[model samples]
Target: MPHIKVVGLGGSLKPGSASVLALKEALRGAEEAGAHIELFELHALDLPMFVPDRAPPESVQRFVDSVSTAAAMIWSSPVYHGSMSGAFKNALDWLELLSKHSPPYLTDKVIGLIATAGGVQGLQAINAMEFAVRSLRGYTHPLTAPLDRAWQLFDQSGQFSDEATLVRLRTLGKGVAEAAKKMAVLG
Candidate 1:
């Protein structure tokens, strides 16, 4: 059986947002590549804003637990202005609790980064995520996905209208899984 667990964290608060669909596709690819996968949509989870001085609620604790057990993760965010959405950023902030662990936050985990934008540009989100992951001591897959004008690619039913986009997302997912497997074995 496949032992690696790859979790996805992203999507906007809006229903049926394209960011959710993008994460679904990437997680599907990870599943196909023999990794167990789950996508956590922040909208549905309704996580509260992270506060350094306050204890986390049950939902936030659950989110932190999920990340702690995962060997790999994919983060897909809807680019707001020039960076990741506040919802996603809040979710990430909760990860600070992991600082209490022996190895600390995200140590040794492999992450795949993705960002989707309604406008003609989205790379900034991915770049920002890369910096965050590195700061958390996690390894990142060199292959990243930054989808520009992402709203145009998905249909009303949330299906991709272009094969190329799907392929790119899938490829990134597979790469992350493969890298995770290697890391797990090495450790």
Candidate 2:
């Protein structure tokens, strides 16, 4: 089997946000399935709002490089006020810069979408994000992992509290890793 690199981009910037926990859950399954992983935290990066007329900042360049180097990407974003969080949107905007350059970074990359929110309504935003990923020429996985009332599902240590949620997350993580593995072979 071909080796795979999995990138998990957590969308939340809050201190210990459940969205970040949810990302950990997904990554766990991927690691167990034999994929090496790298995770990027929104708080750790200094990405700015995307501007169409100008060059992307260095922070944005780092994000794009990370995404480009990965065989598959796990994009985790939180839904805020019925839309993707500003941080999440900013991260995505960085991708648009690729189209401006000679070659795009994510042309054939596989993508797994994940999201967590305070309520069940987060599905709406996840669906919208799914569409955006597809429009970018990415192979968006059909299995999307969305956690509602995210705080209750995960504990303080970023572990899942409920058994079923844990199992489901493991399955999603496996999917991401497996997807990457499959792409690695094809490439």
Candidate 3:
């Protein structure tokens, strides 16, 4: 019985941001589902702007490496102007480097999408992420989580205050891990 690795990618630059906290909760769920986890802390990653012609920086290379090994992924983003944050999008852009791999970018990997927004616009971010994941050849989980009024959902310590939201986030994580495990076993 090998361990399945589920990587989390996305989060805001602000410390204890709602988006980050949501991502943490989702990862915790993945852990509960008997999988190992790796989180790409977006705020801590000093990634340069993505330029198609330029060489990838060390951080970008490391991100690509981490993603390449994952059996499943959880992407949590903050919605901005009806879309995902540029930082999260840029990180996904870096997955282009994975084209050289045997399976190519995100190919056949299970990805769970989550988004947080101040209002009820989180779905826009999740939709954008789904498009990106599909373009990368990853399978997006049918069960996605969107946290609206994100500011009210998490406390100052970054913990979710609502039990229902917590359950949803955890369910998304567990779903991704379970799907990934099945994929790993079948392949």
The better candidate by lDDT, 1 or 3, is 3
TM-score of each: 0.96, 0.89, 0.96
User: lDDT per residue, candidate 1, 1-187, as tens digits?
Assistant: 3489999999999988888888888888888889999778988889988889698888888888989999999999999989999889889989999998878999999999989998856889998899899989999899999999997898777788879999999998988998998888888
Indicate which candidate wins on lDDT: 3
Model 2's number of clashes is: 0
Point out the worst 10-residue segment of candidate 3 by lDDT. 151-160
RMSD of each: 1.2, 2.0, 1.2
How displaced is residue 180 in candidate 1, in Å?
Answer: 0.2
What is the Cα-based TM-score of model 3? 0.96
Pairs that collide in candidate 2 are none
lDDT for predicted candidate 2 compared with the true structure: 0.78
Higher-scoring candidate on lDDT, 1 or 2: 1
Which is the winner by lDDT between candidate 2 and candidate 3?
3
